[model samples]
Target: MSRSTPNTAPDGSSLPVVHVAAGVLIDMQEKVLLARRSADSHQGGLWEFPGGKLEPGEQNRDALCRELEEELGIQVRRARPLIRVTHRYPDRAVILHTWLVTSWEGDPRGREGQPLSWMPVAELPHWPMPAADIPILRALDLPDTYLITPPGFKETALFLRQLQQALDKGISLLQFRLFGLPASGHEVLARQACRLCEEYGARMLLNGPLKLARAVGAHGVHLDRRSLMALNDRNGYEGLLLGASCHDALELEQAQAVGVDFAVLSPVLPTLSHPDAEILGWEGFSQLSQGISIPVYALGGMAPDLLEQSWKQGGQGIAGIRGLWPSSV
Candidate 1:
């Protein structure tokens, strides 16, 4: 067993990366399996998803299967890629290829003499985990489709109706970007929308000032590019989900540095509203996202059909205003 340190690059530049396969072992009751590392082990004393490092020349899935059996006494029968995370610590770096264990044989018990527990997903954030596992937790909390409200839905009744329809259809994550409304009007509609969101068990974010978000009881705020650049730290916004709109690598870096929970990287494809703006294309988007641990949503000219494509290109999911919302409720 070894103590885990912050993954600092060797020679103060680049660290050797070890590829590892990990799993989120879920049981029939919907509780996820968690194991505590031995006190002398790397990332010691923290609870982590059960799985282990990939063996040399082994495929990721096969490695996960082998690791789970050796460490947890379970046989994985069904699993799928959940998220890939690349993290660096002071002493080492790792690429965590995580999967969602949908089906497995045998009850899970720590075969390595470590403590094991089953936890609900909602309780994950309360436990102490490694830095590398933070993004995985955030990914679990988010949905595959992120919706943004169109700019000028002035009628509160109509907006609420449309929002309800979307929510009914299972749009769990949304950002209310009503920029055209007056301050007073925005506040009123925001409160109404928050109430509506609660009814559907959806999370709502306000795309405006932090004060306004707090006043209206939003789950978080989506900072525009300008607001994102103006922030130096994420001190005041602790405990709330913070997100931002990013256009390039620099903006994405800034978002990560400020401790944003997630980000929307836009113009992946040409948009009807901004046809002339430069697009990131899938290749460019993938290039920029390498080694970035934060979850990203692909925006601009996106629809539900492109959800898989978004994930294939290193995004958590897709975000769109027109593509996600119906023209009329």
Candidate 2:
């Protein structure tokens, strides 16, 4: 539903070529189907939300039927619009139309010889995915808040403990992001944090540390803008939730391509972290959130009290470290 870049022709020419891709959202017992791509292709070996490029004259549903059949060897019995996104990669531009297809026939086999897997929704954060997919993940789970944090250390430990107390008071989903910590220290803190999250039955997303997420048994991994732009597709990891931090519409589309669960659209308000960054006010936030099928948490200077306002302006919730862990809301 978000467009990061303007549309363009696909043949490396100036003529406009609107690329339409149709995808199906297969929900089965809380698990969804995903496919891996051949590493040699545009997005090789990456696991992706199963769907394919649309051909000329094909309706959205018709295109979905064809792609699912060709790629997964299955027939969709029912399908409905879920979301639509437009992303322009350097090499290709695509308009992605997605549908929620809850019913189907035949077991999903990777007809293209790409690997196939059924992933549980709750476990979506662990995969290595494209950045644009994050919002979709958010759409599926609908977490109330996106918790950001500084590095894990003795000083931040108190903050985390305070966060833990907040979790006890009903903050179920959180991200343990420490950009400044050493790898070893991060692992140690992640392991400790995982214990707390598990105790509270809360979900934790590690920012930019897929390996550490696995090592510490965290719920999932969060990708920043840089990590996502580099990925061609998402398909490898068998089990895990993948999240992303996205700044624009194109990134959100890419996140969807790689099957990210949810995303954080930042700078809803300016932060001390980057005082010069332009804030995406409620108007801008609404514009972005409107196009996204997945839930979007308004980041940058979010406070607990902003929840109602965010939802009113088309946000799922608010995500922040300072506002989330403060002694008062």
lDDT of each: 0.85, 0.71
Of the candidates shown, which would achieve the greatest lDDT relative to the real structure? 1
Separate clash counts for every candidate: 7, 33
TM-score of each: 0.89, 0.58
Q: lDDT of candidate 2?
A: 0.71
Encode model 1's per-residue lDDT on 1-329: one tens digit a residue.
Answer: 11223345422456766777889987778788889999998899999988887766678888898999999888999876667787778777877888888898988888889899999999998999998999999888888899999888757788888999899899989999887777888899999999899888898998998998999999999999999999999977866789999999889989988989899998989999998999989888777765477889989889889887877667888999999887776
Poorest stretch of ten by lDDT in candidate 1: 1-10
Off by over 4 Å in 1: 1-14
Evaluate model 1: give its TM-score.
0.89
Total residue pair clashes for candidate 1: 7
